[model samples]
Target: MKFTSGPITRPLKMGAYLKVSYNEKRSQVISWEKVNKNDVPTKALAKLQ
Candidate 1:
């Protein structure tokens, strides 16, 4: 998978595999998943948020 600085500030044209987790009553992204495009959901491609 590829890496970008800011998804909220600056979005990319490609898809990414995110490693999301919940801890301390908060949600955070640990790292990128680095998976294939097929592994991602169709809705995620439509909306990157």
Candidate 2:
């Protein structure tokens, strides 16, 4: 999924280069992946500035 450093201002597409994944466990199985970002969308970026 698309990733960003802040809340999404618009819909994002999957398989974005910004997407990240991590591992987690509860009992014996690894949980879902977590996504993060180092940058944000240009529209949102402009707004933030």
Candidate 3:
């Protein structure tokens, strides 16, 4: 990692997903799922800080 401290064992994957549903007042997380990394959109990925 460019700015991470210590040794990195494994690479990070963009597979974690949270399904959200909105209501009249506020939004809530419905469920959490692990989606395929390839299924994720490139624009959604963030650059390392």
Query: Which candidate gets the maximum lDDT versus the true structure?
Result: 1
* Residue runs of model 1 more than 4 Å from their true location after superposition: 1-16, 30-32
Per-model TM-score, in order, reads: 0.38, 0.22, 0.36
Cα error of candidate 3 at position 5, Å? 30
After superposition, which runs of candidate 3 have C-alpha atoms over 4 Å from their true positions? 1-24, 47-49
CA lDDT of every candidate: 0.55, 0.43, 0.43
Candidate 2 — which residues are off by over 4 angstroms? Answer: 1-38
- Which model is ahead, 2 or 3, in terms of TM-score? 3
lDDT of 1 by residue, 1-49 (tens): 4345545544545554554443645544454445667777889767865
> Candidate 3, overall lDDT?
0.43
lDDT of 2 at 35: 45
Candidate 3 C-alpha error for residue 46, in Å: 4.0
* Tens-digit lDDT string for candidate 3 (1-49): 2221135544445544433244645554343345654665666545411
Per-residue lDDT over 1-49 for candidate 2, one digit per residue giving the tens place of the 0 to 100 score: 3333444555555533232344555333233233443455667547645
Query: Per-residue error at 1 for model 1, in Å?
Result: 15
Rank order by TM-score, top first?
1, 3, 2
The residue-level lDDT of candidate 1 at 10 comes to: 41
**Predicted structure 2: lDDT:** 0.43
Give candidate 1's TM-score.
0.38
